[model samples]
Target: MEAFDIAGLCAHPDDAELVMGGTLAREAAAGRKVALVDLTRGESGSRGSPAVRAAEAAEAARVLGASHRESLGLPDSALERTVAHRDVIVSALRRLRPAIVVTQHWDQRHPDHGMASHLVYDACFMSGLRNYRPDLGAAFRPRKVVFATSMTETIEAVPSFVVDITATFETKMRAIRAFASQFSPAAGETVALPFERFQESVELTARRQGQRIGVTFGEGFVTREPVEIDDLLALRGRSI
Candidate 1:
């Protein structure tokens, strides 16, 4: 219920950590309040039960140093941009009143990810309407909405900005690995790659994105609107 400087809204429990864990960690480390809101309990996941996923999500939140975490218990994979759904998210926006919102990219391989993006985008707009959902809370809207890349491979669309996360990259991986059910193979369950190899792939992806902005590790984000710069000299002079 507390206000947060940044809020992450995503389809499943681990989506936030996978897409922008380092950024979240960096924010918290810098004394910024952060929260995570999962649209679903990830009940329909192939490996973990909903309760297990919830516990894992809690652990991950701790690793990221988030102030709070909540789940909407929405139907996983079948999420839609219904008025009811929007109202729920609108309520959260009004309650948390985050200055910045981080969510899954609009273009993602998973249908749920894309649907979640639409749901958050619409809810953010509706939340600002004074006449809308008065029963939820006072109307409120986030100052900015940023999309974290969910693509596992290269994509045509380039990121609007990249956050240097070299210092928090390891913490990000720690948060992700908290979901043992997802990244770690259970007994008798054959995983495509060992946990170490899977982690290496994630690190490699961060390294590749970091190379874009001349950092050791980074996270990419896209914004629909152009970012404003009060002073051009304030920008990091890192080679593009």
Candidate 2:
């Protein structure tokens, strides 16, 4: 596969779309090479089988215009921070060599999400080490690692930045809906709640975030390190 500009590394198949769909769509629409790496096949999800979810994920990737979508085959709902697991992620990072990586927030309600956050962060650092895993791929480090909010019941901290995704909001929804097993009642699959309610909640969150930045729709992300701005005028939402 070709190098990606940005990569979304998440715990489960639909996690990326749930949290950063709009951002991914916007990036891909802008002709930036974007990829998604799902840590697991979401086999533990109540609604779908692994095979079913895999197909759904592919559809979602297509809708989002992602350059590549892959799963690490990690145990769902049972993610751990181990050398083997970290090495797998590190290999992918070196192979993709994305300049920026987006992952779930460190503090999350789901254990897998939290674990994935730590795993991705550590792997990013390890990927930079020349001797970490020479057999997998050449050492390469991503420039930035940003955290996107996912399945968190509360917003513990304010976002460091918000990406305006008004133009791609609908496209994001379409990509999310591709996971019919999780969000579509007509798919004859059991879900935690009605599909309509789930959709409404997602839209509501996007709307609230968008309101924060005076946009119709947006996605928020937090960065552990302070973002360096080359020019204030170049920043989004800045008046020329």
Candidate 3:
């Protein structure tokens, strides 16, 4: 097993870059081995072939300093929580052996994003079971799972915490720009949802999250359990 400090499961090639690129970049810069997993090839997207998306993803990973990135090749726009769908992630969890795993929030406008969240949640539990899927690899479960809410225009829930990405905000933009096929809006184009001013969408969301925490740039994350604090005085950043 190639132990990783952090591993993020994304619904598509650019999902992580859009939402948590800064967090990933910051962690990588702090000497943590960060990796990314794209659940689908994004063949169903409006623009960009799978090959083009994969190449862009590779470049984005390089820009973010990720140790590596893998794609499960799951059917695009057809994500499900079936056993087979979950097995691939189970195998990957065992193979990579990450200490922390991050994925999309369960509540999302896109069904695939929600499905990916559930799939990752189940895979994490199953991967820890020694008797379950023994053929995959040794049992290993990440200690923490984080949910990112920056993918959507409306954040429905209050963030548990916001990462101050002020330092790496530009780095995040560079990574987002790597997926030129998707983020680059063509001239004289008016559209909806993704691909229609997608780059602007990402930037606006980041700015909103940053303003909440009184920072130049920020990425918000949610956790199931309360974050334990050993010393209140040691906690940094002001209240929103």
Candidate 4:
């Protein structure tokens, strides 16, 4: 089987960029294959049009140098945890064949984000079963899966691993700012703060995670199982 590095699955348009853009940029800079899959198009967002969001996503992906970025066409805010959704995610997993699958940690704030997490987690398990979705073509089982924090709620996601993206922090922010439609509001909007202020909320959360591990910027992830390594020294080179 041809192995891949990281495949990120999320609910909204910018979830991956908000959570792991730094790590994704760093990984791609290192020549690792990274793919981003969105469960929904953020069509229901109060901010921008779908076409505008799609354009912004493309720009953000280019900034991150992502190998692939696509959406599953699931309902943005009305995502449900069902076999239908699971089948869609399973097909992508089989096709991408990632060594590490990253997604949002379960959060109660938004149903779409939370359901996206549950659906991906279940789909990862179902993807490994040959009998579950055999007619789809082939079944794929990834070695590991990690969940990114997508909400303000403290999910208590004990990190099975961490990636230090301090060197790429500036690049990450630039990539995030590429979604200008989402970050900068249109004129005549009397909102107390611009969208970029909300974007900083994401940055602050990541910075907090970085502080936990003695790094300038980091992304935290929770795995279903403990991460195994060939040598403990592997961790010595990077912040975990």
Q: Any runs in candidate 2 off by more than 4 Å, and if so which?
A: 184-192, 238-240
lDDT of each: 0.89, 0.88, 0.89, 0.81
User: For model 4, what is the error of residue 12's alpha carbon versus the real structure, in angstroms, after optimal superposition?
Assistant: 1.0
lDDT tens digits by residue: candidate 2, 103-182: 99988888899999999999999999998769988999999999986346655457888888889888888988889877
Q: How far is candidate 2 from the true structure (C-alpha RMSD, Å)?
A: 2.4
Candidate 3, overall lDDT?
0.89
Task: Tell me which of candidates 3 and 4 scores higher on TM-score.
Answer: 3
List the candidates' TM-scores in order: 0.94, 0.93, 0.93, 0.90
Error of 2 at 239 (Å): 11
**TM-score, ranked from best to worst:** 1, 3, 2, 4
Model 1 agreement with the true structure over 31-88: per-residue lDDT tens digits? 9999999998998888888889999999999999998999998899889889988788
Poorly placed runs, candidate 3 (over 4 Å): 183-190, 193-196
Ranked by TM-score, the better of candidates 1 and 3 is 1
Clash-forming residue pairs, model 1: none
Ten-residue stretch with the least lDDT total in model 2: 149-158
How does model 1 fare in lDDT? 0.89
